[model samples]
Target: MAVSLWHKKVIFFGGKGGVGKTTCSASFGLLAAKRGLRTLVVSTDPAHSLGDIFATHIDEEGQLAPNLWGYEINPVKESERYTEQIKSQFQNVVSPVIMEEIQRQIEAAYSAPGSEEAAIFDKFIDMLERIETEFDLVVFDTAPTGHTLRLLSLPELLASWIEHLIAQREKANRLMSMAAVGSPELKEKTDKPDPVLATLKRREERFRRAREFIVDNQAASFIFVVNAEKLPIMETQKAMEILVKYQIPIGGVIVNRLLPTDQEGPFWTRRRELEKKYMAEIEEQFGSLILAKLPLLPDDIYGRQALDQIVQMLEEQIID
Candidate 1:
């Protein structure tokens, strides 16, 4: 079945490195904007090129066109911001001695595994919360296959981790409540709200919300941009399996950068012939999941006019 992307509130374009994910996603965002839907295209890759494609600087977020906005998330900056938010939550609640120790742990956590993903996911959740109110459609031009896969899978994995933390917090609160039955001072302390528990519950709820949005097929779509090559095709297939396993909605595949059929030279002819074989393999492997085929453009995809061409090509094949 042909995929209809215009209606999706959240659309993700992900694939192997150098497969033109940024260009495709930016073009789609531009298409949505042209259709009068307020659109925001975001780049979650650390090495961002979304601004390069649009010929505009978008370090955080900025208006690109009339109805389109662009954002390039910096992992380091987001991680730092996330860490500060975490540290602020413990202030005044914990004693100075304990606060000092907590600060040390937070510093250690800055370098821990998955820290960057967690921080970036927090920002991703922030963007999701603004959907509908701020923009009609939000397109994510994500990192390469492995990194993007981990980012998408974060909702499920982090939700489970948060649930465990909530459970532990609840258990501890119950123990405190039980022990406070005798002493008036302890009873007063237990009766008052627990800041730590409250923070944990809020984080848990945010993760839950993100998971719901990610798995909602009607609201979100994940598309892959692949080149007519062995590596990209294989990577896309693997990425699809992971998304399916997590129940994230798959929109379709876009085979980008196809060789032009009109080229006359022997080398060009051989390249197109090889491209045909891989294109056939893509059809065999993905079948109806193939959404669009984009040819190699004469010039680099930059600025509005070049991006407009991409919108034209996509509209030709993306009909439902």
Candidate 2:
């Protein structure tokens, strides 16, 4: 296994289900922390396995080890945070009835198909903004390939929608102003356009900045984690294409659970042969973008010592 070539950039691990993405991400986070980078690893999957990998009980947010923080985002929590912020800002301008409506809307948004992805995107943005001054790296243990692609592509889609919303808000402001002079009904409509328009404008700016930050190579990168299997390989290829379509930088691919070449026996030989064949295919498909191959250990990789062994494998490569 080789070492990674990129540091500082946010590394994302994604692949098919049961591909050991959480383990690889946890190992990488440990490596980064050992390098004194002040790393944070986050899991976006609804069925998060980071705690299992670390062999530690973790709350929504916890420090698994020194210089290493881990989090499993609860969309409900994020929705509440956003709701509170919006409520506080718009309390005076929006009536109590409208405020309650907005709260319902926010909850609905969080439960919607894309709301969880949006919440994760918001958290990533918050991390990026803070990492600029506080941390050196952030590793994301993303959900399976399908979910990760959806999550990563959200910024672009959200940016377009927000742009439209901003434009609409501006138009609404103009309409309200013109109508204010017309009648009593119109006057009520335009009376408090300032707060609503201002809130939308601020949110639009935040989304735009976050979108730009994510697509920028210096700020973020996507790494696909896969095992040497037909399904995982095909899934990784599809994910790579989707990531490129979204303009997210491809960091590299991590091939986990590779059968070791040593250990003399018929079963060992057969397993090695299969792994070598698949390894060749992976190399041909991904080329130099293949970053590391983690050998399958005799037992499950867990706790600090096993994590250190994984990091040792990573450190052997030359990270460009």
TM-score on alpha carbons, each prediction: 0.96, 0.89
Query: Candidate 2 on 127-223: residue-level lDDT in tens?
Result: 6676747677878898888887877777678778877887898887887788678688878767754777677677677777766766777667788
Predict model 2's lDDT versus the native: 0.79
Residue pairs in clash, model 1: none
- Which segments of candidate 2 are over 4 A away from where they belong? 1-6, 182-193, 262-269
Estimate every model's Cα lDDT from 0 to 1. 0.91, 0.79
Residue 233 displacement in candidate 2 (angstroms): 0.8
Worst 10 residues of 1 by lDDT: 1-10
In lDDT terms, how accurate is model 1?
Answer: 0.91
Off by over 4 Å in 1: 1-3
Give per-residue CA lDDT, model 1, range 1-320, as digits (tens): 43367888999999999999998999989888988999999899989999988887876999999999988888899999999999999988999999999999999998898788888889999999989999999999999999988988888888888889989988999999999999999999999999998998899889899889988988999999999999999999999999989999999899899988787999998898889899899999888888899999999999989999999998788887
